[model samples]
Target: MPELRTERLLLRAWQPADLAPWAAMNADPEVRRYFPEVLTREQSEASVARFQADLDERGWGWWAVEVRATGEFIGFTGLDPVDEDMPFTGVEAGWRLTRSAWGHGYATEAARAALTFGFTTLGLPEIVAVTTATNLRSQAVMRRLGMACDPADDFDDPDVPDGPLRRCVVYRISAGTALS
Candidate 1:
């Protein structure tokens, strides 16, 4: 797996040391607020295992992000293949960070590196981002990454239960677009 570096972060493959913190982050109510539920330690570990396996097989997936200065495991930010059942199927840029990492623009910074890898290294034509309409925090990061939104692209996420979170907005950026 490739390791991505930014001014203050290292987006790399998962390490054994990351398991405990990763689970704790998943269990954080604030961190998992946009999701349907907070994950149990077992569920979080399963997710970590899945992400690690995907990275091993594909050479790219959600990466474990660490703060370079302090060597703290913050969270993950990277690309994922959108599910086939969605109205649009393609690679999506996504991120999740602990509350302590929230206000420092780390998500945008790490995600920019991920987008570069997606467009240049992976030769992807375009990448999309999706979030619940109410997830303004994530949407702001998407815009900061130079992704444009199209209201027509909005759709109800079938995988989410019928609720506010099911109504999702989609944003996209082409491979060569200038990122802010």
Candidate 2:
């Protein structure tokens, strides 16, 4: 896949070295707070393997994000095709970063680049972002990306048990929309 450069980050394919930090991040309570559950090292590796396979086959999926200046593998931000069983199905923009990387604008910066690639490079008509109703941080990033929310689009995630995480909200942005 192609590498995307933002002001301070590089969105690129996953490397062998990213596994350790990626696993550590997935295991972090703060980082995984919004997720349904913390991922084990084995599960994290499996996730990486799945992402790598997707990128290898489709040339695009969740790309590993690195700091340009320090070359640190902070996290990942990219697009993924929503599962067919989901309430809404389409390309979704998502991000997950290490705890230390929080409070920085990395997620928004890298996500914008992914959205750009999705619209311009892939010619996708629209992209959606889904998060638990309580995940205000991610919802803020979606707003910054010019995604609009419609309460009617909200749905309970079938994969999540009936609880706070199950009540998810979706934000969407169409092609040609101006991004913040």
Tell me the lDDT of model 2 at 134.
97
Of the candidates shown, which would achieve the greatest lDDT relative to the real structure?
1
Residue by residue across 1-180, what tens digits does model 1's lDDT show? 899999999999999999999999999988888899999999999999999999999999999999999999999999999989999989999999999999999999999999999988999999999999999999999999999999999999898999988999999999879433
Off by over 4 Å in 1: none
In the range 42-157, model 2's lDDT, one tens digit per residue, is 99999999999999899999999999999999999999999998988899999999988988999999999999999989999999999999999999999989999999999988
lDDT of each: 0.94, 0.93
The segments of candidate 2 whose C-alpha lies over 4 angstroms from its true place after superposition are none
The clash count for each model shown is 0, 0
